[model samples]
Target chain A: MSFEISVSRRLGQGVIALDMAGGDGITALFGPSGAGKTSILNMVAGLLRPDRGRVAVAGRTLFDGDAGIDLAPERRGAGYVFQDGRLFPHRRVRANLLYGARLATPEARATGLDIALDEVVAFLGIGHLLDRWPRTLSGGEAQRVAIGRALLACPRFLLMDEPLASLDAARRDDIMAVIERVRDEFGLPTLYVSHDRAEVERLATRIVAMPQRDTA
Target chain B: MSSFLALTPDDWEIIRLSLKVSLVAVALTMPIAFGLAWVLARLRFPGKLLLDGLVHLPLVVPPVVTGWLLLLAFGANGPAGRWFADWLGIEFMFRWTGAALAAAVMALPLMVRAMRLSIEAVDPRLEGAARTLGATRWRSFLTITLPLSLPGVLAGAVLGFARSIGEFGATITFVSNIPGETRTLPIAIYSALQVPGGEEAVTRLAIISVLLSLGALIASEALSRRAGAGRGGHVL
Candidate 1:
């Protein structure tokens, strides 16, 4: 399995129990809004810890309650693009893209993506947007830069949490194309979260439905 | 311009001393205050409430009380003050440095409050986003939280500087008014007010003080607004 996650964590007063495994291409977490889809992604990314369970990606144990193996988010190398496109507003697009690349681990540099920063930039068609700040970019353009930034990290896997939710249909298609291209060329598994069946149908190779959990 | 204020060396020195003292106080307090504000904004320690209360203590306490506390902690006979004098040749008793210490203490609460408000306003999601992109906690803070909070930092510094310039009771109590040393513009005006037929001198100095404070406020406001325009704003 490229990704194996069986975890339970509390959200306020309720518990979110997720158990799933996947291999290859985009594994879409299909569900309605607030079904803890984003929570699963957060656990895989090591941004949230599970109360008792193991999360292993490509045989690298990211978190294991039994073995006491919990890596920091930075060490996990699982890139995550938030729904709202949390690009650093004060930084220019180029700087935001270079943030992870500048801090790339020795292991990351050994990957095929070592010199692919320029390639990613070209692929995302963000060269024209490089000098501008995030506040100047449209939602579609910002989403592209956000994806480009995560790719520059050479992450073990990519977790995209409804990256197209905030865009119009046309703009959503624009970002969807870039995401498809990244999935094809980046050589990493992508767990795409979404509530829309059409979006998942268009993007996912294999689908795992998120059981609607009560957040109350 | 009055003949008493025709660029007289004494008048100019007073203005220069006030600027120097206030600037030095701001410089000394900025980094420390930023650290304190960030901690207060981000962390939740056991004594966090107590620390917050202590920081704002100077704001509520009388200026003279703060001056007395400074004198107790930083006076020549005090352990910290004596160690400084013996080891580093630094003295705070009745010196210009002492005036700066007083001003910094008085201005710290304002700086910390402004910065904390700005820091709190920053989206924590940005820092979390940064962390997932291979940035450590410190790295995320420097890249995301710190830069996004710049407007607050600048706002705090400007507020601190303005407060330092206007500080009088704490400064005079701690450092005492001395010619060409601890005697800043406020002290000069006060001295002029006490003397018979020194009305013109007092009036000229008071005008300069008002202008300086107003100018600083205006400049800082503009800069803060520009800095804040970046965050929490809708993109086209």
Candidate 2:
């Protein structure tokens, strides 16, 4: 088991809960629009605090409500690829891609798990866009750079939230190929969140459907 | 008018002192203003409203009242003044330093407001993105937030500098008009007005003051435009 999540949170007037333990591959949290799929990913990334639960990824306890142990987002080392790419507008593409490497701790750097910049750049096919600013990139190019950035962070696990929701069909195919290579080559455990059943079927090794909530 | 325009050595000294005091005051106030603005823009806590009000109080209250408050806290025998004197051997009582301090207080509100608006314009989500990429909060702020808000910071500095140069009531009240020390441009103009046959000198000094303020205003405008352009033409 590479991921364990049993968490409940109060969102507005309702409660959202999830309980799952999955293998060391891409486990997709498949659900409808308001079923709290993104919320689960947020909890795993340490962005949203769970009201009560435990989140362990790859033998590391990221959050334990009973033990009063909740790590900060930076300490969690979860590479989160947001829906909008969220690239730094002020940084050039090269700087954006290298941001994670620049921020890695000395101990993490010494561990030899650090992904090479050239290899990732070549793998993602983003070498041509390196000098350009984020504002100048197309949706597909920006998403590719965003993925490269997350990989360079040396994350313990991956949390992706609807990363292809905005791209057109052609761009989606390109990014889908990239995600496939990242999963096969990097071998990092991933918690993928999406509403598109086709995307989940194609990429996910196992599917965990979100529990239905009372909309009334 | 021509004779009046011919600046005397005393007038030159006053202009030089004014420039020095305002520059030092802005340089000192900028980092403090940016810190406060960030707190107000990004943090949510109890008494935030009270803190915001306190920072803007100088802009609303009479400058004389601000000077009086400064005197009570930073006087020679006051706590901050006494500590500085004991440890750093620096004094603020009736010195040019006191004048600069008064100007800084008056300029704080403008500087903080400008910086706060710019900081608020940056999406908090970007910082979150940086954090998930192994960046500590401080690193994200320095790398993402600071660079994005550079224009506003520069504009705030210029605005504060303009305000500092025009400072009069607080300066006159805190540090008496000491010649060659605290007698900045505005104070010199006031002093010249009291003497007979000093109208020409006053006119010249007033014109110079106006020109300096106009220059600062134009520079801030240019910086704001650049800020908008850099942010993909978003009207900041």
- Identify the candidate with maximal DockQ: 1
Write the residue-wise lDDT of candidate 2 on B160-221 in tens digits. Answer: 89899999998888887998889998999999999999888889999999999989988877
Instruction: Note the residue pairs that clash in candidate 2.
Output: none
TM-score of each model's B chain?
0.93, 0.94
Angstrom error at residue B133, model 1: 2.0
TM-score, one value per model: 0.92, 0.92
lDDT of 1 by residue, B1-236 (tens): 46755757788999899999999999999999999999999898899999999999999999999888888888988887898899989899988989888999999998898788788878888888888888899989887888878876887788788888899988888888898889988888998999999888898899889988888787667656765674532101
For each candidate, what's the DockQ? 0.83, 0.82
Could you give the interface RMSD of each candidate, to one decimal?
A: 0.9, 0.8
Native A-B contact fraction in model 1: 0.91
Model 1 vs. true fold: TM: 0.92
Model 2 RMSD, rounded to 1 decimal: 2.5
